[model samples]
Target chain A: MLLCLLGSYFFYGWWDWRFMTLILFSTILDYSIGLKLTDTEAPKTRKRLLLSSVIINLGILGFFKYFNFFIDSFREMLLTVGVEASMSELNIILPVGISFYTFQSMSYTIDLYRKKIPVERDFLRFATYISFFPQLVAGPIVRAKDFLPQLQRTITFDWNRFNSGLSLVLWGFFKKVVVADSLAPFVDLCFEAPETFSSIHLMLGVIFYSFQIYCDFSGYSDIAIGLARILGFDFPENFKTPYFSKNFSEFWTRWHITLSSWLRDYLYISLGGNRHGTFFTYRNLMITMLLGGLWHGASWVFVFWGFLHGMYLVVQRLIEQPFRSLMTKLRVPTILSAAMSIAVVYFFTCFAWIFFRAPDFEIASTVITRIASLEGFHPSTIISKFMALKGILLIGVLLIIELTNFRIHYIPLLVRKPAFRLAAFALILWAIAFFGTFGANAFIYFQF
Target chain B: MKQQIFSRVGWAVLFVFVVFIGDRAGGWLCQQIVKGSGFRYSRMYTDKAKCDILLLGNSRGLGFYQPTIEEITGKKTFNLSYNGMTMDLGKVLVEDYLERYPAPERLVIDVTMCDRSSPEILASFVPYIADSDRLKGLIRDTSYNVAAATSVSHLYRYNSEIFQRALYYSNGKSDNEWLLDRAMSTSTLKHTENQKYRIDARFIKELKATIEYAESKGTEVELVMTPYYPPFAKVVRGLDIFHEDIERGTGRRVRDYSYAIEDPSCFGDFQHLNKKGSKLYMQQLKADGVL
Candidate 1:
């Protein structure tokens, strides 16, 4: 426990040693709060302690991540009314993984306040749980209930665990270095100057970006989960082919599952969830999603991305039944109906991703306008057909592997069968060498 | 625990063995595809592209437009140009061309190819590395990590935009028509407010070496700046400086056609000319005795 705790701190402290104090502060605060909640029979005191924990964790997160954001926004508001206000924005380097660790720390106190989980008394064990190196940065946001017990169990080196973890890590690296990074230059080029590119180029850029963010974030989660497994811990899956989701609700469930579930459990339910009337349920959903979006970054673009998704969910609820009935009446086969639904979900998701990726509203609007105009949509107009072709080939490879894995569950086979294990591992290593973009390219979620 | 450890180590060794076999097999297949490819570089290396004139540049060099040049001058032409090609790769290709084929009558180069150098583009020349020691050395010097990667996994040498083009032009597909076929979009024209390109001394040295080598082989080397849109040409910075540097470095007068084409319809983009533009430019080149 001490070794893991020190190693985790060292891993984080490597970036900025000053930020180590922040992690240490949060760990100590939560550890004390957890124990206090357990000892106190008084409900009031326990609630206050929990509140204190929440305040300090979020307080730290906000000051580092969103202080300049709020100030700049306020200044912008004042400017709109012709009341010129000058606000000095601080140059704050947001410590990497602050959001993930803060949420993970908060979940422990929140669950303890509800008496859903026992308070961990071991300081080192609790600290290790908070700072576990693998998921410490960009997380699956493992809860105390799920992770604390694993700390209690004996951590033996098992071959089965090693094999499965190795495969997962290999697959994750392929998605990240090969697929995501290969798409990055083209996406960056198009986004850097949307007006310069043809309509087909901008459209392809948006599509490539959607997959880039997906592969990037999910690839980190996979590596984190696999690393944890190799060390005798289990992390809940974070993504499940989210683009294949049939509806907005299903998309939320599939994409960033941990963070969405965290919001659903803590924020949405606390805001008088769907048990209330439809209007309030919609309100709760909007608030939760908007917060979720803001949770990603300090930008209004992220909030607008959240707003679009919130509207999608509300609008989908109102029309889904009628749409399904219409499809049934039209005698659409089940496969075709499913295909249509997936396409709709993916298309809207890609649309929202345009806002998420764009530097600001103007660039996003330019991209959308150019794509909508359909000027120079011919193949010959694409500036870099080589890049476009490479992106397509990589995406094709990813889809084939994912679709095949969906049917066969080859992950377990990669663990159980020697021949399968050898082939799969060797192929992944070869693919990484052949196609991987080798640079110190950090995972996209590392900023969050 | 001991048995599990041994089994794991045993599997790891077996994995390495399998990977080695697969890499060699995959690399051989790719080499065959490359040799059989009608892609310009493949044709150059395979001795299928001996001609009276050689054209070299980045994508801008493609404006030399082989089909029109062939028709106008009635001389066999081969373009040794690739998109985003750096000077390092350009020199290697030129030197290799000089070594493999009898000296062509003339070699036309777009001096703007020295504007930028890209390691990624140099790395893309990995598939042709086996054919030239100069290419292997240049790639090693510029991007040693990529060179190491190619050595580790031979299949990696074949993974690039260059190789992808090879596959596209494989099985006897002609690559003579490889040019940007689009006309200028209004947005592109609007966005081409002043732009500057820096010419590195090192790249100029590479260009000088290439020019000297072609000249030594009794090949008349003509360095020219391709035509840009008139509007774009008005605001372009550093071309006079680049021209001066190229002229001083190579001791050859660069035929300046940067503002030669006034018709915007001829331009594909600010940096390149469409087929119409290339045709018009070719006529100018012929009239000026630069063809």
Candidate 2:
């Protein structure tokens, strides 16, 4: 445990040695708070302890990640009205993984306060839990209840686990380096100058951006989970073919399963969840999603992305019964209705992704207007036909694998069949060589 | 435990063996597709394409419009141009052409292709490396890592737009219809200012070498600057510098026809002409006795 702790710190500190102090400070604060909460039985004192843990951890996170954002937003608001404000912005470097670890530490304190999990007395084990390197930077956000017990047992090397884990890691690398990175250049060009490209290109760019972000982020999660499993630790699956979801509610459950579950369990339920009336239920969902969006980055665009999703959920709930009745009246086939729902869900998801990807509202609007115009919308008018063809081919390959994997959980099965494992592994290796764009592009979620 | 360990090691060996055999087999299949392709490069290397007039440039070279040129001049024409064809690759391709077939009566080059060097596109020519030592040497000189990658994985050689085009034309289709056929967008015409082209010194040297080699092989080499959108042409920077550099470097008089086509409907974008514009420009080339 001590060696694992050292290695985790070393891995993180390699980015910036100075940030090690901040992580150490967080670890010590949580450890002390965990002990203090355990010793006290008074409800008020426990509440204060939990509140203090939340405050200090959030305070550090806010100072690093959001101080400039709030200040600049305030100045902009002041300027919009006729008042002049001169707020000095700090030149602060956001410590990498501050958001991930801070939430992780807060989860431990919250779970302890609720008497759901025992307070871990050993500092080394607690620290290792918070800073486990595989998911440390970009996370499945492994919870304390899921991980702490496993740390108590001595782990042995197991061949079955190793084979399955290796399969996951290889699939993750192919998604990241081949599919995501290859789509990036064409997407970047379209987003940089939406007016310069044809309508078809801009439309293709938005679609590519959706898959690019999905592959890039989920690819990281797969690697983290696989690496954890290889080390004899099990991390929960973070994604489950999210684009295949037929409704916004199902989409949320499948996409970023850890973060959404975290928000639902802790934030939504805390805000008088669905036990209250429908109006308050809607309010809680909005507040949770808006905060969830802000949690991703300190930008209004991200907040608006969350807002669109909140609206999607609310609107879906409002109209779902009527829509189902209409479909029944029209005698729509079940498969056709399912296909339509998936298409509508995917379209709205891609639409919201525009705001998430665009630098600001102006660029987002330009992309929308240009695509809507449908000028030069033919395939032949696409400027980068080579890139377009490549992107389509790679996306096709991804869909084929995903569709097959959906029906058959092949990664686990690979452990049982030597011939199948060998063939699949070799094919992936060949695809990587033939198709990957290798410039050591960082995983997209590292910023969060 | 001992048997389990041996089994695992044996499986690992079998994995490597499978990978090696699969890579070789896949590469061989791709090579066959490329050789049987009707793509321009494939045709040239296979000794199936020869011409009285040869056209070369980047995308702008596609403006040569072979069908119109052939109709007007009553001569056989083959275009050796691909989009983003750098001067270094151009020299290798043309030298390879001269070596394989009889020297053409005329070799027309659009000098604008010397604007930059594209090692990325050069690496895409790996599928044709077996036919030309010059191409292999040039690719090695430009990027040894990419050349090494081709050696490591034969399938990697066919991993490019060049290979995609080969697959596209592999079904016995005519390759001459490969031209941009769209009208210029209003947005492009409105925002044509501030565009600049910087000439790479290495590309300039390669252009000079190509001219010398073509002339020595008894082919008359004509260098010309293709037309840009008229408004874009008026405001474009570095054209005079590029034109002068080409003439000075090659010691050949370059006919400047950059303003030949003036219709707004003739352009697909600021730098390239649509089929309408290419046809118009080809007429001018024939009338000027350059075809």
Candidate 3:
């Protein structure tokens, strides 16, 4: 565990050494707060302790990540109102993994204050859990309650776990470099000059992005989880075939499982959840998602992405009964209905991604408006048939994996069968070498 | 448990073996087809005898009409440039050309922006690199040392998008033309000024060295600064500095035609000329007494 903490620190230090001090400060503060909260049963003391955790973690996060963003937005607002503002933006580097560790560490103190988890007196164990390098920067956001117990027990090397974990790591690498990187140039072309491209190309770009983000993020999660499994520390699965989800509610549960769960247990449930009347229920839902979106980055576009998803959820809920009855009334076969539902859910998810991806609402709205207003039967003239086919091939791989993953344990099973496993790895290797555009980009979610 | 572990390990070893074999086999086949392709540019890179009057640069040189230049100049001219070719790579090729064949009467060097850090020549002439020791040294200074070391057997050199290029060439997709000449509005072709426009020290050094090397072999080297749309005038930087540096480095005046053309129809894109544009530009060159 001591070795793990040092390794994690070293891993993080590589990106920016100065940020290590910030992580160290966060660790000590959270650990101290947890200890203090445990010693005092007084309501006010506990409340103050939790508030300190919130303020300190959130304060650090805000200053590093959102300070410049807020200042710039305010400057823009001032300009709009014809008021002169002269505050210059800072050259602050957002400490990598600041959001992930801050949230993970904050959860420990929160859980302790809520009396849900026992006070972890062992500082080494808690520190290790918070700073575990595999998921430190981009995470499954491992819960202290889940991880602390695992830390207590002696971990042994189980072959099944190791093989399964190895399989995931390989699969993750394939998804990231081969699939994501290959499609990136095309997506960048469309986004860089949204007006230059036809409406068909715009649609292709959005569809490509939905897969790109999922593959990019989920690929990171798979590697993290796989590495943890090999190390004999189990991190929860981060993604579970999100595009296969039938509704926005199901999509949330499947996509970024840890973040969604974190929001629900900590924020939404705390805000009276669904126990309250419909008004507050919807408000809580909106606020939870809005905050969740803001958690991704400091940008208003991300907040809008969250807003769109929130709206999707609220509307889906209102119409779930009607939609269900309508499905019944149509008398479509079960498989057919399920397919339609997944398609519908995936379409809305792709629509929201424009907001997530676009630099601002204007660009996002332009893309959407162009998509809607497009006339004539013009297919994409810019993208070649070969390039279009490649996109379809990559997206098809994900579809096959998810659809197959629903039934069989695809990655693990491939691992067990040596010939098939080796062949898969070889295929991934070839794809990466030949198809992947050189210059491996950093994981997309690492910024968050 | 022991049996299960042993069996699994056995298969893993076998898989690695197969992948190694596949990579080598695939690389060798791709290398052969690329060399054997009907594309004349690929042949010009290593060919000894085509050094009469050479045209050299990146895509700017590749896009130049060699047939028209030969007709006008009455000297054998072939474009020795490929897309993504760098100044240093051009220097190496020039030196190699002088070594293997008689020096050309004139080497018309298109002095395009020397900003790209990596040269695509490493991937383009993998087999030629393997066939010669001197050819291998050219890439060592660039970011190909690590790649070259691993690719000693020339397997890793074939790791890029070469298979597709080879397939396209073999399938006769290598059109002997550059610009699409597609009907695009001048509004669409309006160039945005790039913020970053600076030359690398190494690129300038090699470019100067290339001039000196050619001059030593009695080959007169002339530089032509490719024309861009007037709107992108602000984006093209360091031409004056580049000119001064060349004169200081090699004592030769660079014949800059950066503002030579202005008709919107004469341009195919922001920087490049279409076939029609190039034909007119060739006549402009003869008329202006610049060539």
Candidate 4:
């Protein structure tokens, strides 16, 4: 266990050696607090212990990640109000994996204080839980409850499990290198000069970005889960086909499943939840999502991205039953209705993605305004942008594969056929060499 | 359990082995296209080139380096223009060429208003600069980690367009960077007023140094503004300012050729000339004693 913790630290140190200290600091604080929680029965002492974990973990995250952002914004605000307040922005490098590890570490004390999980007596087991490298940096944000019990059980490597894990890793690589990276340069060009592009190119940029972020992030999650499986563990799925959701609420439930569930179980229900009627519920929803946005990055654009989502959820909540009834009254076929709903949800989600992608609110507004005030609708511009994205045909293939994935019940190998498994892997390997975009592009979610 | 694990591992290894053979085939195919004269640098560096009039600039330079110019001038010529080849890359190419090859008698730069360098352009040239310490350092100075990896990784090191040429378009051979006969525009082109051409001081300084270096080596350096479609040429931002800077910096007048052609069918895109346009351009060059 100690060796595993060392290996995890080494994996992190590969990026920057200095960041290992930050992870250690987080682990020690939470570990000590968790032990204190178990030792004490007094409510006041237990509350203080939990607060310490919250303050220390969140404090480190905010200081490293958000200090410069807030400082710059404040100075800009002061200037706008006819006051000169200028200070040099601090030179602070946000440690890679700081946010992910901190959140995973803090969950220990939070869950312990709530008496939802036992305080771990074995320090090595707890330490290993904190810095398990596979999902450490970009995570499914594995909980202590899910991971700790697995540590106690005997880990036996199943041959079938090994094949699936390896296969999952390959699929993740295909999604990331072939699909996401191929789309990145095109999407990047549009966002960099939103004004330069016509509305057609800008629309393609946003729509393409929706797929890029999905494939990029989900690809990372798949790799992480696959790696964990090789070590004899399992993680919950991070993404389903999120773009296929009929409404915003269903979208949340499908996308980033662990983070969504974490926010619901920890942030939402803890804040009096929906039990406190519509007004408070909306307030809570907004707060949770705004913080969720801030969790992504320290930018106001992210906060606004979260704000749009919060609004969508509230509006979706209001219209949920009515939309269902309206659909029933219309008596359109179920498949047609589903297709229509998916189209509506996907287009709106693409609208939200503009803000998510834009570096600032100004650019976001520019993209939105330009899109609304369309001068020319040229299919040629859209086609040219797709041509620039060399692997656009692969997107159609990927979509077909995704749509058929679960429904294809008679897939050879996966139901214990070794030859088919090998064939599948061989085919993917061939595809990777021929179609993959060759680059070591940093994962998008790694910024958080 | 151990036997099962070993078998799974064996299949994985076999899969990779097969893919490696496929990669070899793909790479060999790329070699065929990349070896063709359509890719200018590959031909220039490899073929015995009698370099007397050397053309250097960005994509504009490529379009302006008329194939007929060589015949008209009775001098062997090569176009060193690259797509998005900014003043940054241009300067390095200039120094690198002087160090390695015999200096040309005349260096004609097909000037554009703005030249912006990016890591993408720098990275694309990584494999080409494997033996040059100064070039490796220049790339590293732009971006430390990404440049370091880009220089080393086989997957990232190779240029893709040239690679694609070898695979799909090797058979379509051309003697120059562009197919002059193909008059085409892929999309509607327009000039937006808000799009200002921002100048980099470093690029200007580099341009000055490059001209000085060429002049020191007895190579006459001339900057030329190639012909643009009349409507587009009228609104090129900092067009006058760019000319003033080049002339003012180098103390050499920028020979003006822009807006020389009136025929609409001669133009390809907003900036470039079709074969018909090039024929007219060649006649003008000869009349002006530029050829």
Report the number of the highest-DockQ candidate.
1
Which lDDT tens digits does candidate 1 get at residues A1-448? 6777889989999988999988889999999999989999799998899899999899999999999999999999999999899789999999988999899999999999999999999999999998999999899899999999999998898878987887788888889999999899899988888888889989999999988998999998889998888888899999998888899999999999999999999999999999899999999999999999999999999999999999999999999999999999999999999999999999999999999999899989989999999999988888788888888889998988787876578767655799887877888888887777777778989988
Q: List residue ranges in candidate 1 displaced over 4 A.
A: A407-411, B1-9
Model 2 TM-score relative to the real fold: 0.94
Q: How well is each residue in A118-197 modelled by candidate 3, as lDDT tens digits?
A: 98889898888888999999999989999999989988888778877887887888788878876777787777766555
Q: Can you give the lDDT of residue B40 in candidate 3?
A: 47
Predicted candidate 1, C-alpha RMSD: 1.9
Give each model's whole-structure lDDT: 0.89, 0.90, 0.76, 0.75
Task: Report the Cα lDDT for candidate 2.
Answer: 0.90
CAPRI band for model 4: incorrect
User: lDDT-based ranking, best first?
Assistant: 2, 1, 3, 4
Global lDDT of model 3:
0.76
- Model 4 spans with C-alpha error above 4 angstroms: A75-83, A86-88, A156-158, A382-387, A406-417, A438-440, B1-13, B28-57, B65-82, B85-159, B163-223, B227-254, B258-291
- Chain A vs. native, model 2, TM-score: 0.98
CA error at residue B215 for candidate 2, angstroms:
3.2
Better of 1 and 2 by TM-score: 1
Q: Report lDDT (Cα) of residue A103, candidate 3.
A: 87
DockQ of 3: 0.25
- lDDT, residue A31, model 2: 95
Q: Give residue A182's error in model 2 in angstroms.
A: 2.7
